[model samples]
Target: MHTAPQKFSRALTALAALTLAAGSAHAAAPSYVGTWASDLAQCKVPQERPEAPLVLQEKRFDQYETHCTFSSAEGAGDEWKVKANCQVEGDAQAYDFTLTVSGDTLTLTDDAGSQDLLRCR
Candidate 1:
């Protein structure tokens, strides 16, 4: 038969294990921390105009064809609000965009419209 003190010790040990497991399970992925490629089909783009792949770094976004360096990006719920300076076709412009991620898919919304992108492998 286990003594009262022995049972209490086992209970405390189990509680600690459960706490650690819960903490790890609730840990969330950082906002916009991966490479994503546009799903042209999902965006309903013309076959002739293929979208480029996008790679997001700590404070920069690179689309192979174009590059943008963000001044700030903050997470709000499932979305991130970003302010960036982008260079395209040799012209630099200030841009603001919203990014939302769900599962393996990410949606970027700007002045044009929303474009869905899949996480790159």
Candidate 2:
């Protein structure tokens, strides 16, 4: 009799754990839907006197929270573009950068081994 109750408790615990896992997956990644400007100090390379600011346009698609991506356009005389999936993990939001995130920043490494974004607005 007692064994039956123990099993029921275990089952309930498992169900709760699964639900929490799924919730985190949803929470970890969020839809990107705003215009973010660049923070100069967050960049891998500092901007020169004659350079324009970097701007990013984050858009969500199909109302799916996890299926959103961001397109970044930098103002460094030439047309530079970077793409990444955006998400919110715990208390921090990240752009993924196709690689890593440091603090409130995302690092984009190109084929040429260069970090694309320093800070996202």
Highest lDDT scorer: 1
Q: Judge candidate 2 at residue 16 and give its lDDT.
A: 100
lDDT tens string, model 2, 24-111? 8775332122222245543333233323334333333212123335554332222324454554222323342333344444444555
lDDT of 1 by residue, 1-121 (tens): 9999999999999999999999999876565667787653433332234365677876888764567998998885568999999997668989999999898888999999998888766
Measured by TM-score, the strongest candidate is 1
Q: Candidate 2: where is the Cα deviation over 4 Å?
A: 1-27, 30-97, 116-121
- What TM-score would each prediction reach against the true structure? 0.62, 0.29
Superposed by TM-score, candidate 2 places the C-alpha of residue 100 at a distance from the truth, in angstroms, of 1.6
- Model 1 misplaced stretches (Cα beyond 4 Å): 1-29, 40-51
